[model samples]
Target: MAAPIDRPGARWGVAMCHGFSGSPSSVAPWAKGLAARGFDVEVPRLPGHGTDWRDLEGRRWREWTECFEEACARVAARNDVVFLAGLSMGGAIALRTASRLPVAGVAVVNPGLGFYDWRVRYIGAIRHFLRTTAPIDEPAAPEPVGDEGDYPVTPLAAVYELRQLFRATDRALPKVTAPLLAFKSDADPVVPPSSMTRILRRVASDDVEFVPLHESPHVATRDREALLIVARTAEFFERCAAKAAHPAVGA
Candidate 1:
């Protein structure tokens, strides 16, 4: 794991997670943006990420979830309030963490809770013959979007493992109580629209808010609405932290 971006002097902490096969660079901007506001931030690079795609071949979903939990624990220890944010697959990891942890809030951008394509369901059956596929990165945005340092190819076994993670996360959704802010892109090419709907339907969180992004793709953090993501996340964190500190006087 790369050194996490830590900023001192804040009682609140925010832990950000990147997408599957992607490095911390994917969430670096949002992490830094939170840090700039004086909140301690940690963005841990998951196992097999920031390296060759082959390195990610056999890793399981448990490993990724474990890493995310550990990262959240580290931040929770030092801060009175903690918020978790993630992109794509990382959103599933964040949701899993929120289900188990005492987090103040969670923000998921284009969370990959389910796939619209039926072909992804067959990864386990064909992994023995087809080990990997072409790079999953989408075409460049009209503007220069920085590279997220993701793997060049998608690992078949890893994809299967992600499916497992999604199932596990879905099972745990009703246990989650933390306030949730889900950002869905109207034109996302990677994650299906059902991904966000699944979360809304299952999670027990009463304080849920959904924001629709009209322009961004699956990687909203790097899209044209990137700054909006940062601002909304920061605001959501602040509101949740406040609510945690001062619950409504009555009832």
Candidate 2:
């Protein structure tokens, strides 16, 4: 886990999570963009990531959630308000974590709720025969998204574990009441469109905005529109923070 920027008098903090099989480097650029704008940030390297795929193969999805929870705890301890953000699988984890914690807001890109592949349902049995599956293709995003440090071959066991995480997140979606901002690349080859749709449908947040990343792929965090994500997310964070400071009149 990278130490968060500890600026004095920083009242708000953001904790970002990387996708499965990926380290914090994948989201470092986005985090740096936020930190540059005076937001204290923590991008945690999830357990069993940033090393060999075999290491990840042995880990379950719960371990990933624990790491994310721990990172959020670190930021929430110092800041009066905290926001959550993530990309890909990290986005899914962020949503689940938000349901568990009291966050001011959440911003995510390409959050995975369900996969395009139907075989994922059978991964539990299939893993006995196949040890690994082909990894995500190199995104042809016109410009480079940098090296995401993704696993060359995804372990079948990990895929199964991800499925379990998605199930748990799907069930917990209704508990996410914080203001939310979500992005989904129209051409995303990884997570299906249902991911964004399901989150919007299930979350209890009255303040929800879903942006479509036109022509972008799954790795929008580093794609050509990466800066767009950073800018819009920062704006959302500020708005949410202001709302937290003064709530609307109620009955």
Candidate 3:
């Protein structure tokens, strides 16, 4: 994990999260962009990640949340306002964090709310016999800018834990009141469109923006519209954080 990156401006903070298997590098570009715009950016490594798949074998989703929450607490204590942003599984974690923490806003890209494959549901049935993890066959991305920080494989045990996290996120959705932003790739192969719809329908956040990406794949943060994502996310955080700090002159 990288040390906390900060730039002196506005007393604001943004906690950026990478995907389930990825390292800080997954969200690094966005973090740097936000940091350059004067928001302190903290990109923490997810538990059992950035090392190897075996390390993640028996890890639970609670550990992931605990790791991210501790980082969020640190950011919240330093800045007057704080926001959460994440990609893939991190997106789900950010939403879960928003439900618990008093952050100003939340943003996500291609969040993995559920798997696109039918076989994923059966992982639990075969866990005892399979013991280890196996890769699923999928078509390649046309314009792949892979998450270099990611593990090549995912443990079946981790998949079960991730499923639990998604279920918990669904239950906690109505509790999230912060402003929200989401970027969904029209043709994401990893996560389905249902993920975004789930948030729009479930979250209590009245301030929400759902941006559709036509030219990007699952890793939109590092894809063709990568710069666009950075620009839009930074703008959302700025506007929402300002709105949070200074409300309208009252009714």
Task: Please tell me which predicted candidate would have the highest TM-score against the true structure.
Answer: 2
**TM-scores of all candidate predictions against the true structure:** 0.93, 0.94, 0.90
Candidate 3 lDDT over 1-251, as tens digits, reads 23323334568888888887778876777788777777878989888998988898879999999999999989988998999999989999999999998988999998877887777688777666775654543444455555556667777888888888998999999999999999999988778999888888999999999999998877777777877888898788878866876787991
Question: lDDT scores for all predictions?
Answer: 0.86, 0.89, 0.83
Better of 1 and 2 by lDDT: 2
For residues 43-155, what per-residue lDDT tens digits would candidate 2 score against the true structure? 98887899999999989999999999999999999889899999999999999999999999999999999999999999999999999988977556576656778888999
In the predicted model 3, the residue pairs found to clash are none
**Which is superior by lDDT, 1 or 3?**
1
Candidate 3 Cα outliers beyond 4 Å, as residue runs? 1-9, 133-147, 249-251
Best by lDDT: 2
Candidate 2 minimal-lDDT segment of 10 residues:
1-10
* Regions more than 4 Å wrong, model 1: 1-10
The per-prediction tally of clashing pairs is 0, 0, 0
Task: Give Cα distance to truth, residue 131, candidate 2, Å.
Answer: 0.6
